[model samples]
Target: MTLMTFVYLIAGLILLVAGAEVLVRGAAKLAAQFGIPPLIIGLTVVAFGTSAPETAVSVQAALDGKGDLAIGNVVGSNIANVLFILGLTALIAPLIVSRQLIRLDVPIMIGASLLTMGLAWDGSLSKLDGAVLFGGILTYTAFLIVSSRKDKAAAEDDEFTKELGLDETPKPYGWVINAALVLGGLVLLVAGSNFLVEGAVNLARALGLSELVIGLTVVAIGTSLPELATSVMAAIRGERDIAVGNIVGSNIFNLLCVLGLASLVSPLPIQIAANALAFDFPVMIAVAVACLPIFFSGFRINRWEGLLFVVYYVAYTVYLVLFSTGKPVAEVFAAAMLGYVLPLTAVTLVVVAGRAWHKHGFTGDELKR
Candidate 1:
């Protein structure tokens, strides 16, 4: 890459980090002002804010006719969020899962992942598919709002009121300041995304890499910076729910909101390159499935488990690089996946299911309640 390109890339990253900080702070302030429940704000407004970068990049890529880049970025990012970001955050400290996340958000994330896979099954995501995905987003948002209202009402009851010290009537400034923060944060998000996308595309060309590769690696990671920053901050602050929620919510948004919207703007035709179909997508699914164990077992992800995630992520990246460069890395990855990773994942799932059954019984009726 040219010196100027490197400069832009670095500058873009700085902007992304700064923008995310501003966005999160602004969002939190707004949430507090509006008397929104912490969980609601974290899952919806804050989650969307942190995912703004990914959305912007994907949309821009689609508009620029690099639909694969757009789609790849979102898919790659979801994988990174689960395996890399969450894993690293947990390595720093074990993340505690809120009941809401374990019961609601995690399942939603898995559903979104499966939905994305299904939509792309025909080797393309058309405008119609986008409409379906976007519709789901709207439905999900509506559900959250309704649920938050119920939660808020519940919190206002005698026992909850005493415990949380909630005020029945919020101050007048609540709505106004929240509006300003959301607007300003969105402005910064748009600006930062532009810079990052421009720099990333240029860098890819300089390195003689396909836009798809760039999207899957550099752009993916760059767009995911917001999640990394937010999750790490939440972990450090001991806001375990926020850390875990941010990762899960962002992944869902990446799959549904970002990719879906991009596809609507421009239909993304999947390139069934053997490597992508065989390795990349499966790796993404593997990462998603990997979380089942970490989450279901005590509904917690501890530090050691997090370290294992990071190791796997590093190994994944190395394998990608080698495969892309036409190196003989397939055998290594195949051996690892077949011999160790796949079996371990299967075993973990079985154990988690058995534990859940033992604790909650065979029927899921208790879980529903």
Candidate 2:
């Protein structure tokens, strides 16, 4: 409500972005120096680093017994990552979906989304549930590393390595510098999270909104800025792989790492609000499911599809705002989306998927072009 509140929000966002950038750069360089493959670094370290803000914020909220904020941040972030970040990125330049994403990563993302929902079905995420989610991420990462080794070996020229300056010979004390960067980044992230959470909690109180709603909207979007920047820049630079892969990878981490770690660290189970279980979870699952058909259609997200995605995200956010404010229009808007828009989208996606599959059998890579 006050200027200081806005200052906290802005300052927190700036620090989170700066911290993530430093952490990812340092970690990527360090991984490369240690002979880790560029692809693995991109999939694991960079993705995790970009999601560090969510991890920090959620864990802090959970420790403070703000369970809704913790849960909302993770679920909302995954939604925003796909609907908002990817949507905006694709609009900037049509994103080419790699076969690997459609065939493997997207499915994993969907599975993860479902698994999270099932775990939260009981209304809270226990430490055991957290462990299960955390274990899944470990298994998934190991699988990716092992399976991608051949591809990594065959990569005579890795653009990611070159982009990270990993192609250069290591200098003396390089690891030391990288380590400092990682540490400094962590410090900034911790400090920024405290500020952001405090600001968000205060803002929620001032606006007569729940912390969950603030987490779902403001905190979620603020923390996702790194992914937004990364994907949009990758799109412009023609590194379509990074642009698409980054979003998918980050969603996975947000679920498996951010939420898992938060729940594990909390003194009590992180409770899932009834509203979240009834609405947000379903919406997140639908968004994840939607990715498959969109990616399958020509193995690319066209500009119009991007526009559709952006429009849907706006509609979704507006609905949440209206619903939270107890506006009468919320019901009418929800009715329209349910009765008309959603079914139309479902039919459109099915048609597109069918045509693409018929054009080039599912096994064929012709759509990659």
Candidate 3:
């Protein structure tokens, strides 16, 4: 909390946000110019671009031998993506959930989250685990590209088309300009991430906070700012597909690309924190699973649901604070959540999922019959 620490933290945050905006702008523009469809860009370029800040920060943390920070960042960002980012965005506007997301991406997200937790069970992420995770992303990306081309018309109908599409007048920028933008954005990301991580580590030591705590709270929030900005703007603009899809895709990439690559680059296995294993990882997976019922019920997230998400996030953060500080109220909070809140919530989600499944059995034609 020294002046220099605060200065670096704020400056780094500004740079991360600016860098991600530039990177996404250049990459989105270039992708559009290449005739890549909008849905694909939403799922790939925009999502990954927004997540670049997390990638840069986590990878550098791993290289610097701050494995706790690297792992915490990935885990915390995933949690924040669903609970915090999506919740906030949906509060601004109800998000239209794509059928493909419910059918394909949500399952993949859940599976990836579980796999990450499983790999870390031994208290570390090995290079082999990193390879497997990164490989999944490459394969998934290839499949998305091929499918988008085959179904170009459907892809074009996506909400991102209107958002990321070139101007109606279509003034084309040269390849050089696009490349420079991308390069400049990358430079900014690296420098900003360095400052941010350095400041965070220093602040943690000064405050007697563990690296993992700062990583989960401070670093995770800072790195995820780009996602918040992109998603909230998309939601407000009524580009709901990009808003929801951006969160889902960024969560996926944070695990597959950010954590995976970071573990690979690190000299030693990335140690997993005990608290993360006992509670946080399960919560992350549960949050991923929660989307299934919510998205399936109506193919849209309603205002009430958004509010519920926000409340849950706040509760989770409060629990983290209590547990981290070893406050006397920690046990009471944990008991209440485990004994009452979680069970009720689980029952509610199951009921909704069942209703959705039953209703879905009869399409308009079948219902008429």
Candidate 4:
């Protein structure tokens, strides 16, 4: 890679960190001042804000005619969100689950993910597919607003008035500052994505790796930095709701908003790569479904569980790298993943879904928080 590219890549990482910090803090303050419930802010504003990088990058990639990058970025991001971000955060502190997420967010996330997979299964995400995804975002946001209002009414008077000192009320300069932050954040996101994409492409070419491989491995992990920062910060602040919500919500947004919007700009035709279909997409589904055990088992993710997640993620990365480089050892990894891991994951999903139904009786009590 050229020296300039390295500089741009480093600069992009710095900007991504700075932008996410400003955006999160600003959104928190604004939500507090507006009397918006913490749950709503965590679900919508914080979730969408942190996902801005993926959105920008994916759209740019599509426009540049590198549609695989756009698709791979979103798919890879969802995997990273669950395996990497959630895993690391849980290691720091076990996440406490809210009933709201268990009932509403997690299921919705799964549905969206499955929907995306189904849409792309036909070998492309057309403009119509994009519209459907974007429509889901609109519907989900509206539901949150309506639900928050009803929740506000049913909440105990003290509950509504309880101050979360972590979130500051907006100051007179809040709009000005926030607008600047949002704008700056967008700029950095765009720049960082460009540099990262370019550098990644160059490195892949030099190493004789396919773009799809690079997208699934390096690009995916790199763009997931925002989720890592946001979730880790939320965990540090003891904001378990934000920590868990950020990952789940970002995954949803990455699939719907980011890929949805990107596909609208340019249809993403599937390349029929065996790794993507047989391995990567299935892994995405598996990692997403893996959440059920953690979320439903005890409504929390303990430190040991967190370590397990990290290990799974590391193993996943190693397998991908080895497979890409044509290593003989990859056959063992592939066989293990497909022959054992995939079926095990499927069984887990079925069992978890059944338990969720038995516990909640199809009425979704998990949503009652």
| Candidate of highest lDDT | 2
C-alpha lDDT of candidate 3 relative to the true structure = 0.83
Ranked by TM-score from best down, the candidates are 2, 3, 4, 1
Winner by TM-score between candidate 3 and candidate 2: 2
lDDT (Cα atoms) of all candidates against the true structure: 0.73, 0.89, 0.83, 0.74
Residue 147 lDDT (model 2)? 81
For model 1 the TM-score comes to 0.81
229-338: candidate 2 lDDT, tens digit per residue: 88999999998767998999899889998888998999999999999999999999999999988988888899899999999999999999899989999999999999
Candidate 1 ranges beyond 4 A from true positions: 20-43, 152-184, 267-275, 352-369
In the range 1-369, model 4's lDDT, one tens digit per residue, is 567656755665666566665766666556666677666665566667778777777887887878777777888888888888898999898898777787778888888878887887877778898899999888888787677767664442233234223334456877677677667766776777777777766777777777777777677777788788768988998887678987888888888898878888874443335557667787788787778766775567778768877877888888877877899999998789778865775676567656755676425555343
* Predicted structure with the largest TM-score when compared to the true one: 2
Worst 10 residues of 3 by lDDT: 360-369
| Model 4, position 139: C-alpha lDDT score | 87
Indicate the residue-level lDDT of 158 in model 2: 81
TM-score of each: 0.81, 0.96, 0.90, 0.82
Model 3 Cα displacement at 279 (Å)?
Answer: 1.3
**Which residue pairs collide, candidate 3?**
none
| Residue pairs in candidate 2 whose N, alpha carbon or C atoms collide under 3 angstroms | none
Off by over 4 Å in 4: 21-43, 152-178, 267-274, 340-369
Residue 293 error, candidate 2, Å:
1.3
Superior candidate under lDDT, 2 versus 4: 2
